[model samples]
Target: GYLGCQDTYYVGNFKGIGKVYSQVFIDSYTRVADAKLYTDKTALTAADMLNDRVLPWYETQGIPILRILTDRGSEYKGNIEHHAFELFLSIEGIEHTTTKAYSPQTNGMCERFNKTMKQEFFDTAMRKKIYTDLDDLQLDLDIWLEHFNNERPHSGKYCYGKTPMQTFKDSKKLAVEKNNEILYLDYISDSQNLTDNQVQNL
Candidate 1:
């Protein structure tokens, strides 16, 4: 349940929107990634990215985020009691670790993914379509991200040639064993019991 996190600013403005930023999170094990665009780079936006996307997606997959690694940027580093991002992580019981100073390689997975995203998605999409608003751009980004996680085979250390989603699914049993927890078995059992009861009543 470890993830690498980073934020990147768009090199240029959109047609009418002034400036935008991208908050990205990638599973260090499976290389599954999520990103969202925001108008400004702030602790609130950083928290929002996790609150709105990252955590929910992981929860749906029955995976818990135990820790996250990020750089010592202002948006990510701050007082745990006061900063939005820090408070959010604290509330979610996630450990936050920062990269070693001046050592970008400590978080190289996120760095490489950012570069790949720019090259494979942004550069090509910008050439083909003119985005005037962040929502439209976000929609296209979501589609691209879906393809990235579910369709594209990854060469991650553990992934070999499997797609990120496949790798994530195949590794869930190991994650559960490592954490010494059942992967939502109680909830699934409850649902199954309810279905059996309904069948009996019918």
Candidate 2:
């Protein structure tokens, strides 16, 4: 199963710089989510978000995204040049899957995260009328989302009664342990190879 996932939630144009779009991606296992506001919903924007922002962020964690799950929006579908998203994923060897139409469960992790972002973050922002522009919304969102991932307790079954940040930290710990095991195996294999070479020489 993919630990990383993505989805787009439409808020429509509000104060009218353009249509309000949020590109959200969640770590499926940990429920850690990133929600970024965009003025337009286009394939190019989606591609850039994933390629330039999301994927790079994941790379910093020492793991290439194993897969990404998203809803079937036109922004994610089209021809080669037009579908820069697919191109980028293909180049990076990240498996991309789209949810079945109307079956939100197919990408339920992201779908739920998107809903939470709306209810908890965007809705709160709008209710307070705190923002004069998208930039303001963006600023507030960054702070709220940090709290959501780090301080907010995850009630999901897989969360192990921990906050998203705790779960994510655990995931990293496991990844490091797995890497260490692989290195140990490589060392053993090299030792065996050396023994064989020495035996043949004798």
Model 2 clash tally, residue pairs: 0
For candidate 1, lDDT tens digit of each residue in 132-177?
8889989999999999999999998989999988998999878767
Work out the TM-score per prediction: 0.85, 0.81
Which residue pairs clash in candidate 2? Answer: none
Poorest 10 consecutive residues of model 1 by lDDT?
Answer: 2-11
- lDDT of every model, 2 decimals: 0.85, 0.78
Superposition error at 125 for model 1 (Å): 0.9
Model 1 pairs whose backbones collide: none
Give the local distance difference test score of model 1: 0.85
For model 1, the stretches where C-alpha displacement exceeds 4 angstroms are 9-11, 181-202
